[model samples]
Target: MNYYECMQESINYIENKIYEEIDLNEAADRAFMSLSNYYRLFFAIVGCNVKEYIRLRRIHLAAQELLSNDCSILDTAVKYGFTSADSFSRAFKKATGLLPSIFRKQDRQYMFERVDIMEKYFEIQDLELSEKYPDIKVLKETAPFYGAAFRAESKTPENDAFIGLKAWFDKNEIGNIMPDYRVYGYDIPNSAKDDGTYGYEVVVTIPDDFQVRGEGVVKKHFEGGLYAVTETTVGEIVKAWQRFISWLDISRYEMGAHQCLEEHEVESGFLNRNFEEPENIRINLYMPVVKRNQTEYGKVIVDPVRVAYYREYGSDSEQTAHNVWKVMLNWAEKNKLDCSKCKIYMYNHGFAKVKDFWFEIMITLDFAFQDNLIKEKIFKGGKYLTYDTSLSQLVSSWMKVNQYVSANKIASGNHQWVEVWKLNNWRFPEKGIMIMYPLV
Candidate 1:
């Protein structure tokens, strides 16, 4: 059997033996590889060692049972592969940093399943062969967005700035006026020399008549223009931004130089709402789009050579990931890489095994490519595709790519292909999966 087939067999073995004691030697034999070689290959290819992977899988299965079954912690632990509650607790704590009891107390509302499933199938595609361009119509009329925003230095999305904005809105009762205010991010034009730091604005829109006491603050108009808007519901607000960046990469329309905006359309009425309901909250990301143009509005930049996928444990996990991204960005800057050109993308998968949850974050770095030779080298094994998708059909568009690659029996190579997140701005989130193919 081929290496890919062996990998698939290994995954199947793990899934089947999750409720029982897993034997690595037996599994390796089943896959026709020596135990040592299997362990090495698994770690090298899957980013996790064999025993750790099995434990994670078991924990993942246990979590599902804890949510779906009526068994107690000890019983549940035994039903899975845990030796005892103590062993389970230690393992669980190591994986998720939360005790089983505490996790249970918070209830089963903590899982993000859809995002994980979407991510798993979206990253593999043969874009170079199936280049179907999107039929984008430049929006003649602009849509309306209402939210509260303020100016703050671009750090992480979970910086004190957001908390400060929330506090300011709550203090001034501005949220009462708009009722559903969201924090919107805008990139400042012609501010590249300042590391793109001076060029970003973190603002939210409110009603035109909303009162403000801050100096140098004004109600900016959202010019009605064409926008490519898509809606996604995320367990954390930060992942919403990651989803937006991923969509931008896969979409056909090139980003325009107009202001981008986000609208928080709260389904819960304007008062006393449950904060845990993922369905009641909807985030709409609007990116200005125009037909492909010769005059490039901005260049894409990537820096800081390291990349990893992270999964946030809960509501605060998003902020935690954001802060980590900021630190990485700062490190990249200190290393002489441009920060403004770098984008920290977050990919949220609703069905991957992360800790005891199904959410994982994929982070990538994009570097500046001045010479055509360098750009070609960077995208050396990258695949290109033109996707034809409507606003509502966006998720399915990615699935199409996955299906295409699987059907063609293409093998994933050593390195992932660089995906151009935005045709205009060169933006990519610090999370999510990207597919790359061999260049002819």
Candidate 2:
């Protein structure tokens, strides 16, 4: 069978024997490869070693048993292949950030599942590129570059940009487009081109001593940032981009700001289309990336919710919100308020730094039961960006969402970001905090 099929078979073996000791050598035999080769292929395809995958799967199964109240924690641990309850608890805490006991009693449930290598491999749309997949590298930064940038800011900029730059080369008989000039290309980020327009910039790095010759080529410095880079042959470079993007989606990183680059290193013979032995040339693709937030979130539309609220200004939002929550609870108890939702909205004053921020604590209330003890208002719901996260590092998740809004150029419908407190937890997320930001 093929390599992917073999890996799937080994995964099947792992799942079947998770409650028992799995021989690494036996797993390799199932894949029809040496143990070392099997390990290599598994890591490349599954993004983790085979042993770690099995451990995670076992821990996941163990969690279910603990939550079901069907087995004691020690019994669950031993059944899932841990030698002792202590060993199991340590493993569980390392993988899931909580002890088995704490996790079982926690209000919010954690999401974990077995990896399906076969299905994941088959789903890659650019799987054809696997025949010659380029070796990828995650770079913290690239060297500073000063270059003359040629622009194609139009409705179809990608193709137009290349054509425009190529035409410039042809017009001047500029042999400089070759590797000697260090040429690069990228999609211009966040430009106002969504109105039936696109934007791309092609640049060739130039030395300080080099004389300028091209017309309408603007020269500038491009300070680089984090990038996932790969080198592919000229014939495969374009399609390689699609494959690279797919890789990033599953990886720990997400798209970030700045230029996503295609740096060309052409053979000396490359000028027009017909170059001698063209296969010798290569293109290095650079996809800007940032560490992804582990929080699960998406776009949602919320209907208007009516709530009774208390507003205050505080620098420490969480502590301040906690205090306001106590007051809100007292008010609700006094009024015998029936609530549908509990929410908090914190507003920014449109400044870089502020000593204090305005926050409102509220809960959805029955309109029929009027209460004069607090201010009642209808939260005019619209399209929003929302996420579900645990209390641990909750502030980082907020920072991530804000960064996402900025990186993606998201248009905000309002200045305040809403925190959705207390969910049902029976579904994807029932009893955890969900944060929502207004999106236009």
Candidate 3:
């Protein structure tokens, strides 16, 4: 069989064994290739590894089962190799952005589409080296990364152009540095890339207390922020990069001064596993961003209120806010520290520049928490300007607030701005938000 046919045969085998534990070696044998050859070919064509592909297929089928049969979440999770309901829910939500319960309720397409293996091959072969637009996503702050940095140069294509970093890791015995096997590709700015070949730091995350002791190794912290993320494979990376830049043209955001981050084999499951080559690697591209246009949406006034607050440092404002409120609301129910008024105070002005991000998620408290970390603070009433926005429009809306402040000649007060989640649902706020900024 040809390459495509062999791949399709292997795909058929996977489909047949969707519920069962799939052995990679057996799949490779079915494809009539060694494990390495099968992995390389499949990743090249499918843009994911063997395990990832299986997860996608299994989840896709599980979605179908959830829709068609009267299956419980736990039963479905057990059937699909998920450990628990929470794990299944998290994985499902990560993939489809909806919980299995909600996903089952929605009447939508759930089946996995069969790949046209030959068609994709021909498309890639016929694809010219030209601009290819990427589907960009505005991601909220991500998990922090503490890793080592080094300058690297490309040498051999067969060895994935990562031989330099690999050599460095070996010489330094980097296994002693961190037990984790994940490797990240950090883009170095203004570095040499004369011919579409650039330098990057192939770094791995270390513990917070880990000390660095080596030549040319620098400890760097990627203070996560709002990022414009897109996926690109090694083959079309150059074109994909150009396309990402092009997307920024029409995008609501512009690039920031931060270096781009690429996710390679930077997860636990992927450690120690070698790909056929770096060219076969699929990477998610992350570019820091700022507002492109600052338009004033105008502002309104705020009122004084006593609130019970939970202060979380270095948290993603988007995701963490919801969880914080959920916990706080539950606490209020138990403690009777209840009031109808609830609003989140953003102290760091992450809406303007999201670095070293911190949040003070608060709910109305008649009495304060005696705990030092979670205490009550009175929002001194003041004349405030209001700008409306949502998580998606946060950056732009903040820019609008800035424009309003400049044009109206209003000085902001020392009081922290309040983000009002007025919607009945915090997870998906269809009506957006109101930011009440205290004026001087």
Best by TM-score: 3
RMSD for each of the candidates:
24.4, 22.9, 17.9
- Who wins the lDDT comparison? 2
lDDT of 2 by residue, 94-137 (tens): 99899988888893355567666545543232433444443555
Estimate candidate 2's alpha-carbon lDDT, on a 0 to 1 scale. 0.64
Clashes of each: 33, 3, 5
Q: By lDDT, is 2 or 3 better?
A: 2
Q: lDDT scores for all predictions? A: 0.47, 0.64, 0.61
Superposed model 1: Cα runs more than 4 Å off: 1-140, 144-148, 154-157, 180-183, 186-201, 215-218, 232-252, 263-282, 291-440
Q: Higher-lDDT candidate among 1 and 2? A: 2
Error of 3 at 159 (Å): 9.5
lDDT of 1 by residue, 1-440 (tens): 33333555776777777677888888887756557556755654455777877777677767777777678989978887787999998887677667888776766433312112112311232364224322111233455544445654433322334445655656777645643354465433222222223333446557677666664344565555556554544344466555444444555444444566544432221122233453444345565654444222222223335343333343233355455445444444444544345433333332232332122323344543232211112222233333333322233334444434444455544434333222112223322333222222
- lDDT of each residue in 1-440, candidate 3, tens digit only: 43445677888888888888888898988876668657866775566777888887778988888888989999999999899999999988877778999998885565556565645442221122223332555554455667765655342222342454565567767655654334567543222232344345666666777676666667777665566666666566678667766666555555543446665633211334355544655566666665555434455666778876776543234355555566655665667532334454544335233333345666655554575446777777677777666754454455445544654477879866667655342333445677777787
